[model samples]
Target: MNYDIFNGDADGIIALLQLRLANPINGELVTGVKRDIQLLEQVQVRPEDRLTVLDISMEKNSAALINALDVGADVFYADHHRCGDITQHQNLQAHIDLDANTCTALIIDQLLEGQFHLWAITAAYGDNLIAKADELATKVNLTKVQAEQLKELGTLINYNGYGSNISDLHFHPADLYRALLNYPNPFDVIIDTNSPFNLLQTAYQQDMDNALAIETKHTSACLSVFELPNTAWARRISGVYGNFLANQQTDSAHAVLTDNNDGTYTVSLRAPLDNKQGAGDVCSQFETGGGRAAAAGINALAKSDLPNFIKSVESHYLV
Candidate 1:
């Protein structure tokens, strides 16, 4: 059996698209939303079964992934997430490249020599790496208007994956993959019969409304933290909100905290421009999580620690 696991966003879907276009009839394509990054545990693989993991970090799944390798499943993994360290495996051929400034599309573009450069531009912009997207789009002879349209399409499709869970999203990341696979160009996809654009547009509207309604706790002139009463949409809204604020200015940060059902809160942090320098290691103060300069997240944090959490955020950037 041949299996392909990919993220349900534009990049993940398009990366698989490139793979499929290059090698159609590869195998079954597996996918889920952004939150379903831990997708390796669900599959049952055999020694002869082949697996291609796209846009999901193997380092995050070192154990089950290692087990799959030990089971003799030949794997091809491609990702641009926070992969700590990829272990060596006989059956694994990884295309994992973790560059904050780059993404799976760029990796594919690098390998394919601009054959898919235009789509890669859309993916990069969707991932919130606009400068890189434009740099590549420029090389591909895309007009300014075309580049902007690609960016818009990228943002909308990516927004579709926002939501604490699938309930809030227009479709499951897997379903989104199916939708995207059906259309190589998102602009075309939006106008298609089975398009998921309506769902994405609704989420975008809701995000703007909710984000605007919330008040901010100031850390500095450019930074603010907004607390959302944890709902089905909180976890998914944080990244989108962060990106939203970033576009408003070059020096803004949005730390969105959602109160989870378990009395713990899930934190999704984003730094508007210099994400690397902003919120660099603020979450680690609790010994729970950490991320790069521009973005990071914490799995869980005690609600009672709100005071300490505020203090940490204050000290890291505002202080």
Candidate 2:
């Protein structure tokens, strides 16, 4: 009973695809929408069955994972997320790489000696580490046009993971996987013109339209706050909007705040690119948020504290 559990995003599915292309395996794919992070628990791996976990972090499900390992199933784990120590187990072989440039597909590429480098590029691009992916793509001799195509598909797939739930996404990730299965490379997927990629691009542009309509507060010298309407497009597109606004107005710290389903607001904060002087520390002042120097995300803040949240943002990032 061989079983595969993965992230269900392009990185997750194509990470499995890379492994399969390099070394064929017989297994059942256990996957769903992106929020289904606790996927490994559902798998029934016997003592004799082999399990391969891709992209998902073990720490996110430590108790269940240790239980499975105790049951005598062999596990091959490949991921690039933040996870604790890999316990010594006769049946477990860990291929975890935490480098920010690393993705599960890139880890599989290393195991396969670049046999599926193109797919690795796509995964990396979709993860928004474009510089890292582009550097790797040059080694494989990807033309400028081909590299851009891969980047587009990568962004499209990543955007597909934005929603709080699967229904909020433009298309189900599994449905995107089926369409991708027809093409070995993204170049083939993009050139079809009538491909699902087109549908995704259209939706992405529409989201951008909604994002462009947001109004900003300019509450402080370092922080600019844009309170957004409560809509699927708003929730799905806020982070992207934050990134875009920060880039456009390079000097000011930008925060994209969206009204959450719970009547609270979700905030995305970005640090200035020049100084790497960041404000995740400030976000932690409120509930439901944590991140590092350059980028950080906050889940939900009460509407009542919206003024206080703005004041905190002002004091933290303002010059």
Candidate 3:
């Protein structure tokens, strides 16, 4: 069997989309909600199976990776997140770049020689690599209107990945990927009236409106913290809302905390756009946290640790 495993976010979905489009394959699709990064654990690999994993952090899935290799599965892995020590294995083909400006889709773009360049650009935008996406768009001679469309499409597709589980998402990431497969180019997705883009757009707008009405739970010149209820809508919008907050106040770091039913919190941290250096480090201080410098997250943080987490961010970004 052939298996394609990835994070359910825009970068992961689009990265795999580019690969499958370039080299068509029929594989068992393995993915879950955005927070479900440990997808490799759920994949039961056979010795003869081939696996392609993308967008998820290798460090978090390191054990499963070893298991797949031990079973003699040929693995192709690519990501931009923090990966712990990688071992040399004959069956493993790993493409990992930790550059803050790079994402898995862009890495695949280079491998495919830009056959699906516009889709890669959209993934970059969805991952919030805004400046990089815009630069690529311009290089390809895309008009201003066209560039904005890609950005919005990326953002909405990305928004569809957030949620405590698949129940909160408008479309399961796999279904979204299948929907996108019908469009060979990102522009075609924008032009199709019945595409997932329209459904995602309407859903994204509704979530954003609800998010904006919530006042900040904590605020400072250097940091602004917002607490969202333990509702499905809050879980669904937390990540994108953090991106929205970061874009609004380029100089101020933002933290979006979503309450979890078990008295924990799911945290999304974005360093100030003007100084995107401390978020990943800050989140890493906690056990359940991991991510890139510009953005990072804690899967489940104890309620008591909220203050300590906030303090860490303040000490890192504030004077």
lDDT of 2 at 74: 87
Local distance difference test scores for all models: 0.71, 0.74, 0.92
TM-score comparison, 1 vs 2, better candidate:
1
Instruction: Please estimate how well model 3 matches the true structure, expressed as its whole-model Cα lDDT.
Output: 0.92
- Report the Cα lDDT for residue 298, model 2: 66
Which sections of candidate 2 miss by over 4 Å?
Answer: 24-26, 217-226, 239-255, 266-319
Q: How do the residues 73-114 of candidate 3 rate in per-residue lDDT, one tens digit apiece?
A: 999999998888985799999999988889999999999999
Q: How do the residues 1-319 of candidate 2 rate in per-residue lDDT, one tens digit apiece? A: 8887887666787788777766667677777655465788898657777888887766665666787799888888887754567767888888987665568888998898877788889988776556688898888888888888898788777677666667778776666765676667667778898678898888888998988876665566677788878888876677666656766766777788787768787777876645344455666667766444444556778888888877876776666
Each prediction's RMSD to truth: 2.8, 3.7, 1.0
Give the candidate number with the greatest lDDT: 3
Give the lowest summed-lDDT range of ten residues in model 1.
271-280
Please list all clashing residue pairs in model 2, or write none if there are none.
none
Ranking by TM-score: 3, 1, 2
Candidate 3, residue 69: how far the Cα is off, in Å: 0.8
Q: What is the lDDT for 188 in model 3? A: 96
